[model samples]
Target: MEFGEKIKELRTTNQMTQEKFALRLNVTRQAVSNWENNRNLPDLEMLILISTIFHISLDELILGGSTVNNMTEKLIKDGSETRRAKFNMITTLIGALFLFLGAAFFFIKAHSVEYIDSSGILHENFYLLPTGFFFIFIGIIIFLTTGITFVNSYIKSRR
Candidate 1:
């Protein structure tokens, strides 16, 4: 039997569905489906884990038909992509929050704003514009830097 068929048979014989099996494998159901369909192969580490879980040898898991070496690169790429997406989402949320607060400050002013003078004297002044612009600049910088890093990592991973 083919590798895909073997996986399917093992899964069925164990009475484990794709989702349950994926939970054991720490991967998504789609990934397991792809593996069983022969559309993809797990990495060496995963293959070892699967063999251990099934109480089978690596030879049987791969049918001794050249394991590990032929596994697709997509699994590694998938993990990287998931992490990148999470990082991008967090940064985007924080950046947007900063920008929103900055813009809000431009329209909302404190009734009595106090600040310390250069000479250390206390003074009452509306420093909202400067503070608002400072936040805006920070937000812009965050966007630029994160954007650049995201692009760079994506490019590197493609290779």
Candidate 2:
């Protein structure tokens, strides 16, 4: 039940060729082969990406009763928890900021007056409403992703 074993099992279960799966994962075929053979472990981001692409939980990928799992959990509990917490906090703040900006734009559009000139075109400075909302949506996505990562890591560490 090591990471490599899990990868191989899932890959085979899905009936994906190494090349096809690697392409789907946006990695090299050799990387997939290496993973299946247990020659190397995927890095943090890769592990996350793989877990997401396969619809598998991160815990299922990283915690398979191997020494690496123990080390990874210890690293998270001892060293990386604070960083992850800080990251989640920062993404939340960013999301809030974007949301406020979007709201502000919406308020301006609702409350402001528009004037049309000789060309018969009206102008409103409230165009930023949609722009701000877009940023807010992106920020929220980041925030949620960071939060998910933090919670998953925390739970994995505890286990």
Candidate 3:
């Protein structure tokens, strides 16, 4: 049985209502409902309280049935992996965006020309080159760091 099912079973077996259980746990009735419905999980303290109140071992309360421990471990691991993947994707995208901006600035700087004003004075507007190079350097750093991190995480997950 799932954790939620186990909670519900214990509550019902002890002739306790959801409101009563929530009151004992110092939480809202909705919290109890959520737990029973598996919409959310209780934190460690609450889990301990549950086990204590129900007069059951923590292992029994959490495990509920065979393989539950394994399943929970797998779930946690998967969630972490998913978060890592998302981070990698976001970093890669931001790095690419920085690189594009840098390249665009560099292009503009290179194509810029010096022109004479109405006063017949020569003027140069080549300041963008330095800024472009700076951006390029920053972008490359971000790209390399994130890429390496992503590769490392991917390899780690494979094991």
Candidate 4:
């Protein structure tokens, strides 16, 4: 049996109405209705709570049928999406930081002193220029890579 069907069986067998079950679970009636209808699922914590309230072991509650597969699929999908979002956010922040650093190094005037050796030849440092260019290069690469991936994913999703 599906999780929703199982939940309905348990609730009805216990002589509890949807509203009463929702009250027991501290959720809304609509939430219970949705669960019973397989529109969505509660989180893991809620699942555990449901098992406890139903006076069933977790295995009995979750493993009698295809509920295990359904719950596993949901968990995997949610985890994957969360990880992808975090990865995108972190990469974006890192790319922005690199760009800011590059701009600072390139545009901010360096205050290094010019040194004259015994030969009286003045030597100036230009390290900041190269460093800034490197930073900017890295930032652009990061942005382009991330943007392309995002666009590709968006296109695939649209299809």
Which structure among the candidates has the greatest TM-score? Answer: 4
Give Cα-based local distance difference scores for all models. Answer: 0.80, 0.76, 0.83, 0.84
Worst 10 residues of 4 by lDDT: 63-72
Candidate 1 clashes between residue pairs 3 or more apart in a chain or in different chains: none
Q: How many residue pairs collide in each prediction?
A: 0, 0, 0, 0
Clashing pairs in 3: none
Model 1 stretches with alpha carbons more than 4 Å out = 1-38, 41-76, 110-125
lDDT of candidate 4 over 107-139, digit per residue (tens): 663756678999999887678889898998999
- The weakest ten consecutive residues by lDDT in model 2 span 66-75
Best by lDDT: 4
What would the TM-scores of all predictions be?
Answer: 0.51, 0.46, 0.54, 0.81
The local lDDT score (0 to 100) that residue 12 gets in candidate 2 is 87
lDDT, candidate 2, equals 0.76
Residue 132's C-alpha lDDT in candidate 2? 63
Question: Candidate 2 residues 1-159, lDDT tens each?
Answer: 566688888888888999998998899999999978877766678878888878887776777554565426544664566776777788788877877777777777778888898899987775677786787787778778877887887798689
Least well predicted 10-residue stretch by lDDT in candidate 1: 64-73
lDDT of 3 by residue, 1-159 (tens): 887889999999999999999999999999999988888888778888999999999878877767655326645776797898888788888888888988999788778887999999988766777777888888899889988887787798699
